[model samples]
Target chain A: MATTENGPGALEPRPAPPKEQRFSLNAIQELEEIASHYPERKAACLPALWIAQREYGGYLTPAAIQEVADRLGMSYAEVEGVATFYTMYNLRPRGRHHLEVCTCLTCAVMGAYDVVHELERALGIEVGGTTRDGEFTLSEVECLDYCGAATVVQVGDRYFTHVTADNVLNLIEELRQSEEYTPVKLADAIVKLHLPGSSQTGGGSRTGEQIRNNELY
Target chain B: MGIRNLLFEHRDVENIQDIAVYEKHGGYRGLKKAVKMERSAVIEEIKTSGLRGRGGAGFPTGIKWSGIPQNDDKPHYIICNADEGEPGTYKDRELMLKLPHLLVEGMIIAGYALRGTAGYIYIRGEYVEPAWQVRKAIDQAYRAGYLGKNILGVKGFNFDLYIHMGAGSYECGEESALMSSLMGERGQPRLKFPHAPYPTVEGVWKSPTLINNVETFCAAAKILDMGGAEYARLGTERSKGTKIFSVSGHVARPANYEVEMGTPLMELIEAAGGVVGGALKAVIPGGSSVQIVRAEDCPRVNLDYESCQQNGTLLGSGGFMVFNDRTDIVLLMKRTAEFYMHESCGKCTPCREGTRWIYKILDRITSGGGQPGDVELLLDICSQIDGRSYCGLGDAAAWPIVGAIKAFREEFDYWIAHKRSPVGPGHVPPTPEVVNPLLTLVPA
Candidate 1:
């Protein structure tokens, strides 16, 4: 296949890991279960690729995605197309903490632009740029379905809604102090980085933790 | 109650797509039974089943099918609304994945009942797996004489099925929009005048067309197989048979579940292993479009269409999204409104401008800049949007915000009066003004 100027990644491929770590038992188990939904194992290619990308930090390399396609009994081209289509799946290497700021229509209207700009400045990297420390990567995505809390940003699995420019500094400070700042689960990371001056329950029980704390009302 | 998992049971296996497996499991029994009966009898059987459309609208399926012109020389068409664009709803995809032949069987029976020759399943673009399964099933049906010329040995009755893929657009879920898309045009909905005698009489290239959801047709097939009265016995009088609900969000188990029509809301949450790591705060009863219910009030409701209607909500597409205390309801509504606005086809000014305006107003309010009279302003915009737009999309776009305001007035008031969200800070509350909250202005 000829690589056209408009090809998916005009940039050169990033260097691969010394020896690709084989997929862990848990990752394979998860992939197998998701693949069980369809009559064919190949149907789970996209979701399996997503899980694989998370396991290898934030970005997904062509080699990694192809590995997923192979494991799920699909062609590499099919997995590549799905990876490029969705903005949520990162195709390149990102920082340790891949904080996605939703800049979709709702978030945009709710001051997400300000949060994005502020976060980028605080992290000392551009929107799609990774930090020198390789600790954080900021990117803008479409809807994450958290429209009610406009200006929502998710570091790993956790989301911080009602986010503001002033609150970005405190979020960074929290990330720096905590040894458990590693964002393995996106939802859990969002719950951990509470903005300063927020309600003691942090966003007043909007955290999944609060839901578990019986502060449901 | 038999609670027959006929459609959903045994989802995994190689080449269930093969006709042999389908036949061995009593698959075409309904079609064979219907083959011997008159078309009118088939329609009557569906009518007696009390089955309703599963494509969000909940209209009676048999009544809609019966309204079509039977004697017309023009070709009557049957369309399956597999464009499952409603967020949090994936039951149609699940059905097509689990039992593709059931849909084919139902469509064949329906094609025969309506005196139709062709049918199309307008599948969503994102559903790669389900679409492939349906296409394979259609092919198998052709090979087995279940589709194409003279379906299943019923000579001289030619009915063909085609699979049309939609390009990731939610608007195509609308009937007129779907018809336009099938004709290869941009999917802006056409204006419909009330008392026009439902689209079954005039649809899809202006010939009588019957559009039913994938699950709805499968339910119809179940009715034919189980006997109409027997199927009707499973649900409330107004809404019969089992309903497939796509449960997502803060549930411990976020999967699709099929339940009898009148099952209580609490039973559903329990089935999904309770809320995921939190106290349940709210429930979006039917996708993100219909009115939301607080967790306290959810126990009083049932899964039937009538119950939803009586409770000022809808049994819409059976997409039940659970939200815990962690979810900000205001932000949730804003996101949903934004989806409707973005997907709006911009055909009518009321819908086009109204959805944008609603998003803008809600955006400003939730962003902590809401004005004191913004509540009235928001209500006014929604009222103008409701019933004034060309298609049901506009009304769908407007309903959630209206219902949310009516049900959660205090939450909106707290945001407006305190310059902060009742739930958290960094929320720019709307401007405070001394406005009365009790003036009830009924929607037009």
Candidate 2:
């Protein structure tokens, strides 16, 4: 990784291209509603990126950042700064599923590395790489704050807890059969959460089975 | 005393996330009681309870509430620091997930007390499920007349609550940084009091703002419901009410245990089904930020603020992580250093550069490149970083390394001299990969 004066691999400023508005009418309305929650429009920068991430399919392209900046009346650089500051916003295109395994203190002690190794061997991709099929991208994350259930693997908005090297393969198989916990779904859920009546619309990553089983609480 | 479930009493109840079940179990009584009383009286009640901030700082809650200028023309804002990013702590996650109404009620009460115009729960982005529960709770509150204009029919008394999710920055857990993040800037912290006004004096959009942890506000609602004096009787003189310790690591039943403040540290371990895999080796009594206590010192330390301080650790965020004998102290500290290094907001010179230096040294030492003066160098760097940054994250990064050295210096020396863990092979924390190729260039 190259360290620029700005920071680690700082986003190079490119000449502004012709603006392409990718946000749907609903996204525009959603951004406005979330912006109205705050005193100023700039406060909507984080949520706008989430909407942009979903609109642009799971990662923030320069164009996606531009779209968010244009929507919230912030500069592209400003919105890009916010997007890059937080770890959740994907700055690059990811696999359909981003398997964020927590290898922090507790999880490390609980054999999180072994799980990472298993995922790597299975997917034939290292921690920071995506599978050839564009199915999964494995990355070691810090604590998801669910240490009670160690070796927590977060796929989109859903948390698969008590995950070990033994059972992780099973989780991978389950994920392959489902489309619920993709990065795009995560962005959609997050975007919907900011809207006032989103709960009624049943947005977020929890599966209907999980919610019916009362697994979320 | 162990497992004193105040906020978590109804946690196990079915559909407790719903507003109706919460009301059936005597929810909104605190807000109903608060609406009848004078605003100062609400502050007075909290003052009598002796509650402190549950968000690691342990600052007095009542004083924080009263700090807001009363009846000021500028609209006051109440912010909940729900960004539960501390590695070993997840109590706030459970609080918001199961008992969303409790937090909602607590925030509404605080709003009424502070004459707040609105409240925001700054949830971390990874906690989408918990955030969804909160979203439902807020919607239910609005429908039930607990949030939004003129709550309970009080004229000119309106407070709106909204959920603001973080894009995933641990530094935003700090109050000033939280405000900065809420205002949609990079999640770097601002200057504190004397350099800048207190958050109560100028926060968010530069209005009088009050920020507190999720557990603190939940306890406030409980204090109002149970009467402040009664709630005061639960914990120690300084640290009042029950504190939720998210006990993780090598425990059989790793879960959040809500125990009275003065409970024995060992008893909480027993409640968590004791240490698993091996004998209890060490305990990071209050999250990874606090000092690591040796097993010999465990009995002497109680889970209160003063007792923990006497034992050379603060009861920080109640993230009690227990480790068994098989755990490697040097490797554990290495991982801890890695967390801080990754999460440092890069705003300050000390934390930004210092955390990376700490991680590199730890990584080197763990990868069999330890030198004699390496331990001392680590300490020196920690000393420089501690209290040098604008926020507590820098100090937090410093404390554990300094504490580990204080308690487990022999482990560092053992790894250096023997080129192996004191605990032998098959130790936890896999050997460090040369993740950063630049590290290969460093003289070892």
Evaluate all candidate structures by whole-model CA lDDT and list the values in order: 0.69, 0.89
lDDT of 1 by residue, B1-444 (tens): 223354565444444545687678778889889989998999999999988888899888888888988888877889999888676676786677657888999999999888886887777644444555576677668777887777767777898776665544678889888876665445667756464545677777667889999998898777888888888888787878888777766667666778888889888888888886568888877876789888778988998888888888998977777776655566667766777776777778998899888878777876678788888998999999898888888899889898888878888787677756676643321221221111101100
- Pull out the clashing pairs in model 2: B287-B319
Per-residue CA lDDT of model 2 for B1-444, tens digit only, reads 678999898888777888898899999999999999999999999999999999999999999999999967998999999999998999999898788899999999999999999999999999898889899989989999988888999988899999998987889999999999999999999999889999999998989999999999999999999999999999887888899999999988998999999999999999999999999999998888999999999999999999999999989998989999999999999989988988888889999999999999987888888889999999999999998998999999999999999999899999998887889878877675523323212211
TM-scores for every predicted model: 0.67, 0.95
Q: What is the TM-score of chain A in candidate 2?
A: 0.88
**RMSDs, each prediction?**
14.4, 4.3
Off by over 4 Å in 1: A1-217, B1-6, B10-15, B193-197, B425-444
lDDT of 2: 0.89
For model 1 the TM-score comes to 0.67
Model 2 misplaced stretches (Cα beyond 4 Å): A1-13, A204-217, B433-444
Each model's iRMS: 17.7, 4.4
**Poorest 10 consecutive residues of model 2 chain B by lDDT?**
B435-444
Highest-DockQ candidate: 2
What is the CAPRI rating of model 1's predicted complex? incorrect
